[model samples]
Target: MAIDPRGTDLKRLLSEDQGGPVVMLNLLRFDDGGREMYDQYAEALSTTFLPRYGGEVIYAGEGSTALVAEAGQEWDAVLLVRYPSRSAFSSMVADPEYQQVTGLRTKALTEAVLQVTTPWE
Candidate 1:
């Protein structure tokens, strides 16, 4: 997800998790559950990024939403990715090989938001 160019501080999100260099990525929502399409998107991501940059898909899938966020709109999936470093995470998104699959990812979503944060302990 694209960071908030207007307000986000990339450096802040870079230091949240303690176990290693972490990026607390929160995917807010999706248009619907396009399982078949999503699967294809997932495969492309795992194949390209994981093998080279090296990170784990720490979490995924939806859960309850609090009675906040305007109206409790729940997530379609939540992905927590722990890359080797902030630079590595940023680099993955820009790689020519990974860029080829960007369309796959965008096709499965209607609305999505992601924030890379260092995550406060």
Candidate 2:
């Protein structure tokens, strides 16, 4: 239900940092007409914010048939975004320009999961 990270969430993310890059796994469930809005946000992110913050979209795709999930667990879309570090990601989200377009993302999703992943050693 939470579309955006809260201040506490960002603080925790920073406090838990082990250093190095972080990949964010985003599972999205959209509202009606939400895809279009999300696309707009994505465009700005890919073209501007991501580059500014040393991040990139590793993978992004619509969800397909779920072979191993509960009946109501299928996501509408998924994205893997890699950031140079947790601080980079936190800073991006805090950017004033990014804040202007963040409403699009918030309005677009009914539910989402933004999980952090670190590569195995």
Candidate 3:
């Protein structure tokens, strides 16, 4: 049910960094009217914060029929975001300007999974 990462989460993310880019997998379950709010946050992220922090949205899409998950496990949306490094992502989230718009994201989701992925060697 956590919509955003906490300070400890960010610290752990950095401490576990293996070096190089990191791709985050986001699974979102929205509240009523949440999609619109999330869109606003996404716009600011793509237009400003992402570029400023060397990150990019690798893929983003609404969830479709789940062929392999449990009945209650389907997410409303999914996003794959790639950051140059763990520190870059941490920095972006800590930016004051980004903090201003982050509330939109917080208000938009009822539950979320923000998982970090490392590419296979």
Choose the strongest candidate by lDDT: 2
Q: Which lDDT tens digits does candidate 1 get at residues 1-121?
A: 4422222444444444344566547564444655566677678877767668987788877757555665546666778877787667766766788777766666677656666655576
Shift of residue 53 alpha carbon in model 1, Å: 0.3
What TM-score would every model get versus the actual structure?
0.69, 0.98, 0.98
How high is the lDDT of residue 62 in model 1?
A: 74
C-alpha lDDT score of every prediction, in listed order = 0.64, 0.98, 0.97
For each of the candidates, give the backbone clash count: 4, 0, 0
Supply the global lDDT for candidate 2: 0.98
Worst 10 residues of 3 by lDDT: 1-10
In candidate 1, where is summed lDDT lowest over 10 consecutive residues? 1-10
Worst 10 residues of 2 by lDDT: 1-10
TM-score of 2: 0.98
RMSD of each: 4.4, 0.5, 0.6
Q: What is the lDDT of residue 116 in candidate 2?
A: 96
**Which residue pairs clash within candidate 1?**
13-117, 13-118, 16-118, 16-119
